[model samples]
Target: MRFSRVVEASGAVAATRSRTRKTAELGGLLDDATAEEIPTVVAWLSGVIPQGRLGVGWRSLTSLTPTPSESPSLTVAGVDDLFVRLAAAGGPGSVALRQGLLTELFGSATESEQDFLRRLMTGELRQGALAGVMVDAIAKASGQPLDLVRRAHMLTGSLPETASLAVHGGAQALAGVGLQVGRAVAPMLATPADSLADAVAALGPDLVVDFKLDGARIQVHRRDDEIAVYTRSLRDITAAVPDLVEVVRGLPCRTVILDGETLTLDADGRPRPFQDTMSRFGSSGELADDPNGLLRPFFFDCLHLDGIDLIDRPLSERLAALTTVAPGMRIPSVTNPTVAEAERHFDAALAAGHEGVMVKSLAGPYAAGRRGKAWQKVKPVHTIDLVVLGAEWGSGRRTGFLSNLHLGARDPDGGPPIMVGKTFKGLTDALLQWQTDEFGRHETHRDGHTVYLRPEIVVEIELDGVQRSSRYPGGVALRFARVVRYRPDKTVDEADTIDAIRALLP
Candidate 1:
């Protein structure tokens, strides 16, 4: 298929607010795609690259200003092949090789295609073609069940592969996708509840309340002695987390898949700041021996234990299996607690230096990769991760630093990040200097007062709540939002969505 067709579909998807319209536009595009072109098309429309990061930052892309072609002739395969070559270019002279390839690709693209390529290469392609809508599109195009397509995508954790399967092998092939011992599946996520009482009321008394630690989410897979640890985004950090590997390996089960969190604890056994844990978790090499820096694993759910797959089973059954195998590593929890008892547990968790308590329904099955209402998190303060859109230059006492931050939330429909609010509060002098230096590296353009940036940095913001506003694109603005911390462990994709921000509205 032609690259222009995909670009047109993306534009169409972004131009509409109705999800059905967006799905229809994408479905039509997918229907015309050849089997060989399905993966690339699906990945692009889903706002990602099959080759992952190509190391092509905004600076490199902005340096090249190729004139647009008059007519469209570029094919999806041709563009994908160039991206592959660009991703592979990494040596003494690889920079220039990548530059040459990009220039060639962009030079052949038309004006609209050039804009699409620019946004895509910089991870700013927000065309409402998110994974959920694309899954529907795949089903619509291939005449398969939406449940089957969604299950295949969840099990494989690759939308492109799922799209290919739906288009080629049909429902039977999608049904064949199952949990693999060595592979990482998307971890189930929790929705937010206003309070512990609210959660108890919503989920009823048959609930399991566990302490929600302020740490990184990990999914561990063990087959005999071999062990693998993956982040919530499914990135493998097994080699960097050997301590965790040994812990999982010590389990009695021959084959198991466990979901949990990992973090370093202080001398007093309290969890340290999240940055310290992520620094070690995101490392590429073996870490030095540090007593406080050693990452410890805490299991919460068992997806697969021995020969039994517990994902389809209720949470009560899965928790039983998890306790049988990794009893000591289980997160501290209370089951079937009354509302008053759950409140006490929440208080205890807060007093113990944890973020909050997770109130989970006992009868809900593991809804992997989906943030359903079966699990709810209640915290004392509202904290959210948002993208750093731009920063204003400081004045007076804060002069010479980037003081005020422009924040944005991810659009659930896959459009560009929606500006929610800005804040100059909660920033220390040290943080000011750090952001000034850091934001410069990501600078796309600058005005007299602010430096606009690429939507790559994720910062955690603390807010009183959200209020409806006409100033922001999402029709809601954060109230008294302040910086909590910079989340280096998260990506724009993982940042809280506008729908989440809207949920906070009063």
Candidate 2:
């Protein structure tokens, strides 16, 4: 397939707001892709690179102004080959080599293709070809069940691989994909409930309510003596989290996959600030030197145990398995609680310096990678993590500071961040200075009053609610939004989606 075909499909997907139209366009593109070309095509359309980051930055892209070719001649394989070489170019003079390669590749493309390549390389491809849409597209192209494709995607945690399987091998191949004890599967997610009572009402009385700690999500995979720790995004941080590794290594079961949260706690046994936890979590050094910064793992769900896969099992059975293996490390929870009892549990979690409570149905299976109502979270305050889109200059007491922030919610369909609202509230003087210094590092452009930024910074915002409006692209506006704190622990991909914000409408 020609690279131009992909560029055209991406453009068509971006030009339409209707998800049906976008899925059709992507499915058509997939229908034209060869089996060998499926993986690369799927990854590109999903706004990611198969080779990961190539050390290319926005500055490098802006520095080159190559004159595009008159015709489209670049093949998909040829472009992928260039990316491979770019990823391999390193050591001395590697910068120049990479620039030369990028220039050569861009110079061989037409104007539209150059734009596509630039956006693709810079992680700015904001088409609507998200993982879910792509899964549907794969199902459409391969004539397979959507559930089979989605299940394969969840189990494998790789869209490109799932696409290839669905396209080449069909439903039989997809059905064969299962939970591997050593490999990390996508973690199950929870939906936000309006309140504890509402959550209990939705999931019924036969549910377990556990504390929702404000910490990083982790999946521990233990196969005999080998233990690996992975984040929610599936990045391996086994070396960085030795304490967690040791804890999992001590579990009774030899082959087990545990889903849990890891956080740094103070001497009084209260959870520390999220930033402190991430600071230690992201470090690759030996944490034994700092006793106060050690992370403690709190296992909540057992996905597999003793050579048995329990993802298809009920939550009650999984909890029973977890209790048998690591009862001391299990999160505090109460099973079959009434609405009032669940309310008390929610209060207790907040009192313990945690975020809120997670109400889970006892009979629901571990629906990995899907945020269904089987698990619901209820918090006392309404808070969301949004991306920093831009900021306006401040005046008066906050002179010279980038005070008023432009906040945006993630588009669940993988389009660009949708603007929901703006706020200068809840920012302290120290925070103002920090934003001024940090926003400068991520600046993409500047106008007379505001400095636009790349959507790289995630900020937790507390809002009273949301109101329907036409002022923003999301067709809603935030009500009394205030900055809670900057969430360095989160990426833009983890930010709250526009659909979530809209769900707050009264």
Candidate 3:
């Protein structure tokens, strides 16, 4: 198909507010695409390349303002090949090569196509239809069950390939996609409950309350001597932590995909700060040679063991299978505890310097990537990780420091974050100094006392509750919001979203 068709469909999808209309538009595009073009079409609509980052910067795209053609001439295959070349161009004089290719590609595109390409290349395509909506569109177009497609997408961890399968091979093809040992399935998520008593009342007496550690969520996959560890976002970090690889290798099974948390602990066996855990994943992680700095894994749920996939089984069955393999590494939990017993357990977890307790339903299937009432997390305070949109300058005692942070919740649609509220309430002098130094590096614009940021920082905020509001794009505001700690471990994508914030509304 011609690339203009996609540009037009993108514009139509963005223009409509109705979910039905957006799905229909996206379905129409998918219906018209061939089997070979499905990957490119899906990737473009999702606002990413199949090859991942191509090292193309905003300057490279904006500087070359080439003239556009009167009509569309580029095919989907031609555009896909150009991106492949762009990703391949690197090291020594590759800059000019990328520029020449982009120039030619843009010069051949129409005005509308050029605009779409610019947004797609720069990762700024804010179309209302994100991955969730696009999955619905694919299901709509292919006449398949939404749940089946969603599960396939989640397990495969590739919407582009899922689209191709649904389009060409139908529901039977989707049924074939299962949890692979080496590949990371999207982790099952939990929704916040009012309290432990409320969660027990709702989820029933057979609840298993496990300690929720304030550490990095890691999904470890081991096959023979080889092992791969992925973060919440499914980015591989096997190269950084060799010690973790050795730990998972000791499991009884030859092939196992285990989901759990990893953290560095003090000499007393208390968990360290989350920042220290995350430091072992990013840059400078390989050089971290502290004797106490070990990412201890506690297998909470095993998705796959040996040659069998356990995701289809209930939590009870999954836990049983986990016991057969790595019983000692399993997260500590109490089953069907009374109110007093649960409280004692919660207090014990707190005393151990952990975050809180995660109460889970024993009958629940894996339910990968779905956050519902099936699992409930209870923290000491109503704390959530929010993205920092901007901050204001401090005055008097706190002069020359960044204060009064503008906080936002992540949007579900992958657009700009929704502004819920702002807070400078719980920040200390040390935090103020840190924010002043770090935030300026991400500053986009500064006006008067406020300096706007690129929404890259995630800060943990404690709020009383949410109230309906006239201000804020989310149509709700956080009440009694205060800073807890800066969540350097979280990305803008991992922070609590606007929809999650609204769930606490009174």
lDDT tens readout by residue for model 1, 415-478: 6799999999999887898898889888889989999998889999999999999999999999
Which candidate model has the greater TM-score, 2 or 3?
Answer: 2
lDDT of 1 at 259: 97
User: Whole-model lDDT for model 3 versus the true structure?
Assistant: 0.86
lDDT of 3 by residue, 106-222 (tens): 999999999998888876676766778889988987899998899899998888989988988899999999988788888888888789898888877777899998888889998
Q: What lDDT is reached at residue 181 by model 1?
A: 92
TM-score of 1: 0.94
Q: Estimate each model's TM-score.
A: 0.94, 0.96, 0.93
Displacement of the residue 387 alpha carbon in candidate 2, Å = 1.9
- Candidate 2 backbone clash number: 0
Q: Which has the better lDDT: candidate 2, or candidate 3?
A: 2
Question: How does model 1 fare in lDDT?
Answer: 0.90
For model 1, give the 10-residue run with minimal summed lDDT.
281-290
Alpha-carbon runs more than 4 Å astray in model 2: none
Best by TM-score: 2
Supply the global lDDT for candidate 2: 0.90
